[model samples]
Target: MSELMKIQENLRETARKLLANGEASLVIGYALGSEVSRVVPAFISREDEVDRLVWNPLCINNLAKYLLDYRHEPGKVAVVVKGCDSRAIIRLLQDNQITREKVIILGIPCPGLINPDLVAARLDPGAQITVAAVSKQDFSLQTGEGTFTFTRDEALLKKCRDCEQHTPVIADFMLGEEIPPNDPGDPFVAVKTLEELPVEERSAYWDKQFSRCLRCYACRNVCPACTCRECVFDQAEPCWVAKANNLPENTAFHLIRAFHVAGRCVDCGECERVCPVNIPLSLLNRKILKDMKDLFNVPTPGTSLEELPPLGAFTKSDPDEFM
Candidate 1:
């Protein structure tokens, strides 16, 4: 069997068994979408639905975030995961939100996922397009114009371009071609340049950037970790920040959102993807992430559930920045 087929077949067999045994109510994984290059998450509730599951480069949505639905009953589920996704699952376990055994994981070595939307915008601006495949630095896409090749750097999600993990850190049943582990280094060169700027320059820089906020709060709403029953943004009695679209409030809103995620964010880059204004909010989170590593020497909170939340834990050597 071709390696790809073997990976897909292996996962389907697992899904079929899980469904047949009633071990899970759903198997959340990507399926071919109606779009030319679309991959949609399938909530497979039956063995027959296993046919729709697919493994490919275009499967970019972080399905782990969907588990935040408040009404989901207590039962096991199956989820497909990549390297970074393992960290997300670990974080959920650390919080005692989801038990380790509740979900069957199909871990796969993640090379990287290309950002289709970014490609569409840079070239066609408003054209409909789908990524057919990505082989290292080149991405093939079917656009309104025709099929084309684009450099991966131009189309890759910023976080993915700097991704430090290529192999699944945790898995019950892994699929796809095995790849070597990626270097776990400070990959935030661009963010570091921004941080090196003077405080006044940084303030002025984000002023123009955050000014574009529409107060849509799509970032917070789509986040899996922001699963509070009632978000602080909606609370107006105490008025933590104004509901208006002013720059000050917008800055506070973005800052607070990043601060809240400090060590907990899994760096799925969902907040950046969901933002309509095209803000690079992940930079803020990465700043804190660097501090979490340098100052506390802690693995970013969600990287593993064995450790407590960085802010939730205290030690003698902790940095005085938060003090």
Candidate 2:
């Protein structure tokens, strides 16, 4: 069997046992989307429904935030998490958004995921994916048409290509074999490249990107760091930001958000993934991440629950130039 199918089978068995044994009332996972190349979040409450769960390179949604919907609900919630999604779980835990007792973490060691858009571009949209496999070097799909393969460079999601964690940092139950994390070179290389640009060029680049903002707030909605019940952008009493779509308002919104998640962003790349205009939101977040690292000598957010976010904690030795 292909590696993807093997993982899917294991996931189904695990979820089935959780539901059947009353260990969990719900299992949040990925299900086959309308298109074979796409996958959508699945909530399984019955043992039979566990079969709906699947694992593959295209299973990209961060399932961690869905736990909030059930945090107040009765029974334990079992959530499937990739390495990136696992970080969001830690974020929620550290924020006290959800209790560990109510959560059952099903962790998956992701090699990387294939870009579904790239897969759709190459295959028939309606094609049924009979089998799928992924590795460090390439991803392959089997369909009635035949076997199709793409080199990692050509098809891997950029976020996956730059990912630092393959095995989840925490798991109540690990669903797949441990996959060692790949060395993605310097994580700050792109940030450094952007920093080296002229001041005028840097400003112009961001202005051009932010100018196309629809303010749909997909980035904010999908962001795991955006756990606020009533976000500042939506408040009318304080009227912190107007509802306008102009470049100035949009730039203000983006800057305000970048700072809001300054030390807490796990660099999951969901903000960039969900942005319709293709704004490099991850790059913007990473710039702050780099600065936080340089100034605070801190590790990536959500990697550990023991370490507090740099901005959230105060220390005597913290840089004080701003004061």
State candidate 2's TM-score: 0.97
For model 2, the superposed segments whose C-alpha errors exceed 4 Å read none
Return the top candidate by lDDT. Answer: 2
Model 1 clash pairs? none
258-302: candidate 2 lDDT, tens digit per residue: 999999999899989888889999899999999999999998999
CA lDDT, every prediction?
0.75, 0.90
Over 177-278, each residue of candidate 1 has an lDDT whose tens digit, in order, gives 777765746667868999899999999989998999898988887675676777888998889998888999999998988888887887777788778998
What is candidate 1's CA lDDT for residue 258?
88
The residue-level lDDT of candidate 1 at 34 comes to 63
TM-score of each: 0.86, 0.97
Model 2: pairs clashing at backbone N, Cα or C within 3 Å: none
